[model samples]
Target: MKLHALSPLERQDLIKQYAKSFSERAKQHDEEQSFPFENIEELKMIGYTSLSLPKTLGGQGIPLTEWLKLQELIATADGSTSLSIGWHMGIVSELNQKNWPDSVLTHVTKKISQNGFLLNTAATEPDTGSPTRGGKPTTQAKKVGSDWVLSGRKSFTSMVPALDFILVSASMDDDQVGYFLIEKGASGVRVEETWNTIAMRGTASHDLILENVKIPHDHLVELVVPGKKSPSGWLLHIPACYLGIAQAAQTEAVSFASTYSPNSLPGPIKDIPAVQSKIGENEADLIQARYLLYGVSAKWDAATDEERLEMQSELGVAKYHVVNAAQKIVDRAMRVVGAQSLFTSNPLQRYYRDVRAGLHNPPMDDRTLVLLAQSLFN
Candidate 1:
C-alpha cells in the first residue's frame, strides 16, 4: 500500500509495516548512540517528513488527530526518532495556522516536500534554561547593514545532525528576543557535540554554536512577546512519544510472559494472577492515555482557532496524565520481568529511562498541575 493518500486503516497498516523495521533497529541505535540515519532516510523516502503539512502545501493534509496517531505509531518503533522528527513536524503543523511571510513559508514548504529538509529550534542556552521559564536568550543578534548576524550558543538542539534549518533564539540590541531562521550552511553555524545524556541518545541533541552568522533581515521569524503564547496541539507529540515507549514495554512484557516458562510454574507465567494483574494494569493505563491523546487532539483539530488556543490547561493535563501513565506502565512492565529486565540487552530498561525523560519535557508536571489548579479557581 502507498504510505500516503490512504484511509485511516491503510495509513495505520503502512505505519505498522515501517514500525517493525524501526523497532528492530531501535536497540542498536541506543547501544551505539548513533543517529538513526537509515531510519530517517527511509522515512523521508516514504514521504513522512512532509506528512503534517496541508495538502495545499503538497502534503497529506491530515487533521491533528490523524497526525498525532501516526506519530504515536512512529514513536512505538523508536522514541528518539519520533521525538527528533517531532520538532520538525510540530513546526510544520503550527505554520499552517500562523501568518508567516509568504515567501519564507513557500520556500520552507517546498524544501520540506521536495528536499526532505527538517527544521528545529535552538532556543535553550547554558546561561538560561528552557525559554519557557521567561528568561531572555543569551544568543545575540546584531544588525550588520541590511542583514542580521547572530552569535551565541544554544542548548538542547534536538536532531542537530539532521536539521537543515534552525529557528535560533537570540537577543537584539534593544534586549527584545528574536527568532532568527538560520540555514545550516550559514558561515558560522556549527554543532558542538554536547548531548551525552542517559536517555534518547539517538536524538543527537547537541549544542548549537553560532559566531556571527549573517542572514537577511527577514530571517527573523518573530519577536519574542515575553508572556504565555497560545497553546499548541502539535506539542501533543511529546506525550505520544512516551506513550509509545510504554506500548513497546507492554509488548515486551506480555511476550516474555507468554513464552518464558519456569520449573516452578505449570505453564507460561502469563497464567499467573500476578502477571495478569500487571498486564491488566498496563492495558488499562494505555487505553486511558490513548483516550486523552486522541480525544484532545481530535477536539483541538475540530475546533475554531480561538477554541483550540483556549485549551492550554486541558492539553497540559492530558499530557501530564499520559506521561505519568507511561512511566507507570514501564515500571509495571519491568516488575513483570523481574531482575532480568534490567539487563542491557532488554528494551525495558531503555523504556524505563526514556519514559522518565518525559517528566522534564515541556509543559512540566509541576507547571501542568498549577495550570490545572489555576483553572479550578478561575
Candidate 2:
C-alpha cells in the first residue's frame, strides 16, 4: 500500500482508467446536478479515492506529486466531479501530514477506502466573506463535558448531498477558532436547498445548519492558529480544476471545427488559419500553466518550512498566471466555436461559466498582484 508498492507506470494506468469513467458520467452529472455515484464506486473499487492514505493504514500511499497529476487527469475529464473529490483527497493528504493518532488515521482511511467517503470544508460564511480576512466564525462550538455542541449556519458547503463528513470551522467563546468533524446523521444538522449557482452546480454546494449539534471530543481538529500560511501546493488545485475546464472547452472547440463548415468557407472550420491559431494559443497557455504548477510543486515538496513560507509570493504568481491564462484560453475556445458556444446545450457555455469561477477562488487577482508587488518592492 506504500507509494513504493506501486510502480510509476501502474499509477499512471490507474489514473487513466479513472479518467475514462469520469468522462462517461460527466455530462449526466452536470445536467442533473447529481452526484457521480457510479464514478465514486469505480474509484473505490480501484482504490483511487484512498491513494493519499498511508500504506500502513491499508490504503495506497501515493506521493503528492503523483496525486496531483492524477487529479489533473480526472478534472480534465470532469471538473465538477474532480473539484468535489479533490477537497476530500486534500483533507486526507493534510491529515496524513499532520501524523494523527494511528487509530484515528486507520479508522478514517479504512472507511474511505471501503465505502469511498467524501469530506469537505465549511469555512466560508456569508457575512464574513473571504476566509483570508480571518473571518470571525458565526458558528460556535461549546464544550459540553465529553462532547461539543455546535450551532450556526455554514454556506457554500460543497458536495453536501454526498459528503460523509464536514470539517466545520467554529468559534469557541465566540472568538477562538476551531474545526470539528460533523457527520451527516448528527442531530440538529440540516442541509438547506440553497445551491443555485452559475457554475460547478453539480457540486451541490448547499448550506449546512447546525442547531445544537453534538460532536465527540475526538472529532475535533485543533489548530494552533485561525488561519495559518497555506502551502503553495494547495493553490495548484485551483489551477488544476480550471485547466481541466479549459481543456474541455478546447475539446469542444476542436470537435466543432472539425465538422462545422460555413457557407463562406471552402473546407471544414479546422482548415481555417484563424481557428487553428486560437487552438494553438490555448494549447500553449495550458502547457505553460502545467509547467509552472509542476515546477512550483516540486520546489514545495523539497522546501523547508521557512523556505516554504517565504515562497508565498511565488504561489500567488502561479495561481495568477494559470487561472487567468486558463480563463482566456477557454474564452478563445468559445470564440473559435462561434455563437453556438453560447447555447445552453453546448458544453462550451458551461466551460465558459465554470472557468470564470476560478477567478473568484482564493488568491484572487487583486490579492495575488498585491502579494507579488510587495515581494518585488519590499
Candidate 3:
C-alpha cells in the first residue's frame, strides 16, 4: 500500500514493525562496526526514505512531529542508522521548504523518487569544526570556465557510502559560502575510512576527500552569508535520535530489573524500592523531553516563515533539554542494571556510548546556553 494512503497511526505501526526487525541485527552491526546497508534498502523498499519529500513530489508530506516519530523508532533499534539517514531526510525537507532554485530542487527530488537516491551535506572540516560555529570553510570554489572545481577535505561525512549526491560547502572568491551539489563517484572524490569513534560506529562517518572535483555551473545550488541563515527546525532529528536511544536504554534496564533474581533477594530487583525509583525517574524525564520535543516540532509545522525565524531560541532550548535528559536517563538506566550494564554483550553499553554522541551534535550545550542568554536580553 502507498504510504500516503495510510492513516498516521497505521504508518507509524508499519515503521515500528520495521524497527523491530532492525533491532535484531543492531547488535551484530554495532559489534562488527559495519554499516546497515540492508536496513537502508528495506527503508527504501517500504518508502520510508522518501516520506519527508513534499507531497507534490509524490511523497507522504509527513509533518515534523510524525517524521520525528519515525526517526525515533529507527534510533531505538540502531543509532548509527538513524543518524546516518536523518541527515538525508532533514536536508531534503529543508530544501523543499526553502527558496532554492526550482530546477535543482525538482531534479534532486526526482532522483530521490525514481532511483532511491540519498543526499547529505558535507560541511565539517578538521581545522574549522562544525559549520554552525561560524568558521569559514577553507575549501575553495573558483570559477573555472563554465563550471566550478572544488578541493577540500570534509570530516564526518556521514553515510558517504550510500549517498548519491553530496552538498559541499566552499568559500567562493566573493567571500561568501556556496553549497554545491556534486554527484558521488565524481573524479577526485573519494571517501577515506577515518571514522574510528567509540560510538555510532555503523554510521560510516568518514572523511570525504575532494581533489579538484568539478560540477556543472548550476550545481552551486545556494550562496549564503555565513552565520546569517535562518534556523532549521529540521535539526530536531538529532534530539529525536538521542531520545530513542534513551528510551531503549530505559527499556533494557527495566527488562533486566524485572528478572534476574539474586540469591539474597526474594524476587526480581524491579520490586525493590531503589530500582523502582530509578525507573520512575527515567519515566519522568522521558515524559518531559517528549512533550517539549513534540510540542516545538508541531509548532514549527504550523509556523509561518517569518515566525520560524524568531524560533531559533526555542529550537535550541528543545535540543538542549532533550539531549541532556536523554543522557541522564541512559546513565540512570545503567545504574539500575549495575556492573553488568558495562559488559560488552549488553545493549545498554551500546546505548551508553550512542547517547554520548548527541552532545557533540549541532546546537551543542554551550551554544544553546548562549542562545538562551541572548533571548533574555532581547
> Cα lDDT for residue 209, model 1?
91
What tens digits encode model 1's per-residue C-alpha lDDT throughout 1-378? 446767877888888898899999999999888889888887887778888887787677677787678778888889999999888888887677656678887888899888889988888889988777777888899999999998899999999888998999888998788888888778998888887888998999999999989999888878776444788888999998998899999999999999989999899999999999999999999999998889898898889977977899889988899999999999999999999999999999998888888998888889888877888898
lDDT of 2 by residue, 1-378 (tens): 322346877777767767887877777777777767776666666667778766666557566667777777777777787777777876776565654445555666678767777677898888877676667788888989998999998888877888887889888974678778777798998999798777877777888988999977877766535546565465577777787788878888888999998899898999989999999998999889989988887787788878987777777788788889988998999999889888877878878877788887877889878767877797
Model 2 weakest lDDT span, ten residues long: 223-232
lDDT of 3 by residue, 1-378 (tens): 545567889988888888887898888988888889989988887777788887787566789899899899899988989999999988887665656678887888898877778999999999899888888999999999999999999999999899999999999998889899999789989999999988999999999999999888889988876666688988999999999999999999889999879999999998999999999999999999999999999999999989999899888989999999999999999999999999998999999999999999988899889878877798
Residue 230 displacement in candidate 3 (angstroms): 0.8
Order of candidate numbers by TM-score, starting with the best = 3, 1, 2
Query: What's every prediction's RMSD, in angstroms?
Result: 1.3, 2.6, 1.2
* lDDT agreement of model 3 with the native: 0.89
Give model 1's TM-score versus the native structure. 0.97
On lDDT, the leading prediction is 3
Candidates in order have lDDT scores of 0.87, 0.77, 0.89
**How do all the candidates rank in terms of lDDT, highest first?**
3, 1, 2
lDDT of model 2, residue 364: 80
Candidate 1, residue 276: how far the Cα is off, in Å: 0.7
Compute the lDDT of residue 244 as modeled in candidate 1.
88
Q: Could you estimate the TM-score for every candidate?
A: 0.97, 0.91, 0.97
Compared to the true structure, candidate 3 yields what TM-score?
A: 0.97
